[model samples]
Target: MYQLPFTTVVESATSNTKKLELVVHPSVSSKFKRYLDIVGSLVGLLVLAILFIPIAIAIKIDSPGPIFFTQQRYGLQGRPFRIRKFRSMVTDAERLKSLVSNEANGLIFKNKNDFRVTKIGRFLRSTSLDELPQFWNVLVGEMSLVGTRPPTADEVMHYNQRHWQRLNVKPGLTGEWQVNGRSRVKDFEQIVDLDLQYQKKWYPLYDILLIAKTFYVIFGRIGAC
Candidate 1:
């Protein structure tokens, strides 16, 4: 029997320690990349300040909760961090998710239309405006401008060995999955595959390309939300 770092018992008796260990690579510890996140996030925060006011106002008028939404998410090395986003859904959205979720494709729940999403939430999600506040997370070193998508604690709990590999580096607001076609790919396993692909190939040039493609995705409004 093999003991695991996360728990006393493994998820499967046949699970291979070598395969699980392979998920975390040594190159994940990149000091220069962390520095880049700080500088880039600060610059992004400065630019987003202009739109913050109007977006905040819209959210205030549309809902009664706090202006920002904060939740626990896994960061570099599977550490927990409070990731912030603009409030796009109603305060009770999480509580109502089970009822509103359309179906589960493996670990993720998807719904083209969810009832708990406020009017402002709909627009924010569609434009990816809800994610603006994550720049602060990036600045503080909890995330990156471009990397694997962060999974919530609940999501992480559901992750198998391959999916946990995403946490080898800082999570990002945009990544290969976001620019590739976010809404079109609803399968949870496929999302995990993309994250693994990112972990194996992170570099400054790749980050730059991801950022450029992200801009195009944002402007082109293709498969967002």
Candidate 2:
């Protein structure tokens, strides 16, 4: 296991003022995990390279917009990083969000039948192919192969101090929430609870198990879209 000295920055549980506390460094078990992230991302990128042309062509033909979507997401310790995804919605999707009613739980927005989604986008979401570009984030150390899901800037803004604990670790391409029933999970608190559970019990073998379960979820087509 590999460990890094870290400082925990949090607002006082009782006070409005922010505070910093240095906790004893925990064994990270991340050296091999980082190695796996590098190797996995490389292989993923190679597959992306092979699929890019066809996917790009499909996206362009289905809608008039960029092939990729980039958004700012909170990473480890609430650091901001750009996350990339294959575009699956209208070019004006974010702006149009205000016009539609949200069907998701907590601070997130989700609509299985969202009109903003293009025909190809539906398939992309169902297959999770839209997330393929995140392998680049993994390669760059902005993300992990398995960990907590990254929150959007808007999502983070709504979070309380307890919610910030999830940011202690690098966000992931897939995680407990995803495998446990991602699209099906309605409450944001449940998601937070699962992330906290992962943090408390983190180990290399645990990550491997989650990764295996993620494959089953993906191929089984459960809780997708």
Candidate 3:
């Protein structure tokens, strides 16, 4: 695995040694970036709060499940944490996952017309309103305002050393994979490349730019599905 910081900043796994070695990266301890995350998340939470009532009503009316969906996702250095989203699918979506064929290649999964998605869920997903609750994750420091998208445990389980490099930075609410083309990019390897690219170019300014770019991407609906 490449890295991400929380309890520890980063750890590198050498294929030859098969041992985890600690490697500190600048983004891990940048107080400036942390400050950005705090401020950004608070703002995001406020926005979510403002929109919660209506969104909740729509979700309840459209589906018979909880308003929010929380799933175990791997964070920086592959740590497990619950990533929250507005429920975008039927209650039994997880159980029925095997019935839906994955259109994406490699460790990740995706289906454009996933039958499980509720009508309101599609709107939430395309507009990214479904991800609002994750600001809490960013506020609490489990994620960043801008970083790689968090992956599920099963997806991480299948990661190779090259793919592990993406986790070197904390998962973000939006990032390279996100702004470039969310689920539109089907190949998992391309996603790894984007994540690594973010790691390479990361800085507080760059993070700010990505955060700014996210708004454009979302509103324009460039790559929601």
Best by TM-score: 3
Candidate 3 residue lDDT tens string, 9-110: 233342232212224457879999999999999999999999999999999999998998889997776667898899999999989999999999988889
| lDDT by residue for model 1 (94-212), tens | 88877885654877777877778889988888888888888998887677888777776667665666666666666887888898888777888888778767766666667778888
Candidate 1 — what's its lDDT?
0.74
lDDT pick, better of 2 and 3: 3
Better of 1 and 3 by lDDT: 3
Task: Compute each candidate's TM-score over C-alphas.
Answer: 0.85, 0.89, 0.90
Supply candidate 3's per-residue lDDT for 47: 97
Q: Which residue pairs of candidate 3 clash?
A: 3-167, 3-168
lDDT per residue for candidate 2 within 1-225, as digits (tens), equals 433335566664434645444232231336888888999899889989999999999999999989999999977766779998999999999889988888877877877778999999999988888999999999998899888899987787777666777777788998889999978887788999888778777777788899889889989999987
Q: Model 2, which residues run further than 4 Å from truth?
A: 1-29
Model 3 misplaced stretches (Cα beyond 4 Å)? 1-22
lDDT assessment of candidate 3: 0.83
The lDDT leader among the candidates is 3
Q: Which model, 1 or 2, shows the larger lDDT?
A: 2
lDDT of each: 0.74, 0.82, 0.83
